[model samples]
Target: MTRILCIGEAMVELSAQGDLWRAGIAGDTLNTAWYLRRLLGPSHHVGYLTRVGRGDFSRRAVDFMAAEGIDTSHVTTDPTREIGLYAITLTEGERSFTYWRDTSAARGLADGPDRLQSALVGCDIAYLSGITLAILPDAGRAALLDALRGRDVVFDPNLRPRLWPDAGRMRAAITEAAGLAALVLPSFDDEAAHFGDADPKATIARYRAAGAGQVVVKNGGGPVAYGGPEGSGVVDDLPRDRPVDSTAAGDSFNAAYLAARLEGGTCADAIRAGHALSRRVIAHPGALVRAAV
Candidate 1:
């Protein structure tokens, strides 16, 4: 079995269901971990690394992960810090976020002993996102990077500019993280804002130079580009006529792509899997849809 260690924040998510509001747990890495475990089933061991508070919501999040068959043994608990939350408003199938995560427990994940280290060392892959980088303090970030040095890291620069302190700091952190990752999955819009790339080719070049062996740049409504051991090429063009919500498109893409690769699917096959999953996700309301797996 391939063990995957996913590190990030899992927060209470409040989304609207018609006139009523529904509460659930959601985060970038958490969402990926859920889908990855679902896709891989019992063959892959998926463990999540984060911090949660001693509250009902935190407990509920753990219960949710357990129900999904994601291992939460490595999740640290803090009594002081509370669980974070974000509200989502959907309009015409499009979603926008409003956060209340100033003192999220996940921010303090690296403060304790090397417990997380043992879990990570046992994993075949370590996956995280840019939001994971933003929430951590300098010391925590340093500790995380150090621990991840010898692992097969999968990074999705799921850039949330509002979560970052500044553009320069975000770039520096992303550059450092990209260098450590074996595979980098970056969205074109985020890359354009961070690196000022004129197009996907330029963005792929920038990330490739940073030492990523596999680079997959997803362009919204445009062709996806890849530069890897199998050689560089455009994976596929997006559907022109489909209406998309576009919230979890990239996250679902990352999951399907990684799952395909881990299942021994070719690069082109993986990209197709990514696109197929993403198209379905964006056609729905939130990050996940109620379709048959």
Candidate 2:
């Protein structure tokens, strides 16, 4: 079986539903893992690596993964800390978040090098994101990067400026992390805002120069630019409807794109697959949509 391990934080998510609030479990890497679990069949094993607390929310997060057929064996528990929480506010299909994660247990996910190494053992692909590094301490990021060395790494520079101490540190860390990935997926808008990339090609060029084997630049509901060993080209995104919530568009796209690539599809074909799934995901209300793509 092909084992894929996604390393990052999963938190309790609250979204406004009419006059009340709806709660669920979701995060960037976890959302990708969830979509990957659904997209890939039984032969592919999807695992999660993170630290949560003993609280009810934490327990629910673990149980959610188990219920979705994702491997939760690498999920470590913290006795003193609890899971992080975020609330979503959507305005005309666009969403924004308010986070409460300063003392999140996931900040220490890479504290033990031995545990990190052990968690990665036998895994075929290790998937992480910019948020993963942002939440981690400098030493933790170093340890995690060290453990991920030489693995088939899939990275997403899911840039969040507030998460990092400064722009320079975020760029340096993202560039360093991208150098370790076999595939680097970045959103063009984020790259333009943070890295001052002129366009999607510029984003792809930057990552390729950072030693990444392949790079896919995602443009929100527009054309996708991708390049690597398999091929290089632009694939137009699937025709999309008015989105009810665009929360997990990129996350689901990454999952589907990677799933297609892992199943031997070409970069262009994979980009199409990613866009198709992402189009379906944005029509739903939450990050983890319960419908099939």
Candidate 3:
């Protein structure tokens, strides 16, 4: 079986519900892992790599991952630190977050990376995001990137500037990570806001120059620009439904796109799959919605 390793944290999500809250496990990479497992079914093995603590939230997080059919064999066990937590606040179909993740166990994943290295031994593809780099300690980040040297990487620079020490550091890290990736996914608004790219095409050119072989630029409610060694063009006929919550739009899109690509679909087909899933995801709440969503 082809094993795809998703490297990052899986936090305890607390989503608002008027006078109450809905609890779940969610994170950028975790959302992708969940959707990929669902889309790929039994043909591929989807593994999630993270470190969690010995608390109840951690235990529930593990059980939640298992329930989603994600491989947890390589997940690390850290006793000192507990799982991170984040709460969601929705407003007119968009979402905002309030995080309390100082002691997140996943920050220690690459502190002593023997197990992290061992887990990648037979992996076919590895996926991670900018958030993963921003959250790690310097040594851990360096170790993680060094270990990813020769794999086929799929990276998303889900830029959250506040997560990094500074813009320059985040830029340097994202540039290096993009160079390591076989395919790079960047959202247009985020790129424009961070890199001052004039448009989606500029975003593509930027990553291509950074050494990524293929680049995809996602424009919210607009055409998606794709450029790769095979060929490139715009996919504009994507779904345009009004989103109920835009929490995991990009993450879900990434999963569907990768699932289609892995199964030998064309870029256009992958984009369609991505857009379709993303549309469904936003019509619901939270990062990982129901299968019907």
Stretches of candidate 1 off by over 4 Å are 240-244
lDDT of 1 by residue, 171-199 (tens): 98988898888999999988888789998
lDDT of 2 at 288: 93
Q: How many residue pairs clash in each candidate?
A: 0, 0, 0
Error of 3 at 224 (Å): 0.4
What shift in Å separates residue 281 of candidate 3 from its native position after superposition? 0.5
Q: Choose 1 or 3, whichever is better by TM-score.
A: 3
The TM-score between candidate 1 and the true structure equals: 0.95
User: Which 10-residue span in candidate 3 carries the lowest summed lDDT?
Assistant: 284-293
Better candidate by lDDT, 1 or 3: 3
**Candidate 1 clashes between residue pairs 3 or more apart in a chain or in different chains:** none
Which whole-number lDDT from 0 to 100 does residue 79 have in model 3?
72
Residue-level lDDT of model 2, residues 88-204, one tens digit each, is 999999999999999999999999999999999899999999999999999999999999988999999999999999999999999999999999999999999999999999998
CA lDDT scores, all candidates in order: 0.84, 0.94, 0.90
Report the C-alpha lDDT of model 3 over 146-194, residue by residue, as the tens digit: 9999889999999999989999999999999999999998999999999
Q: Rank the candidates by TM-score, best first.
A: 2, 3, 1
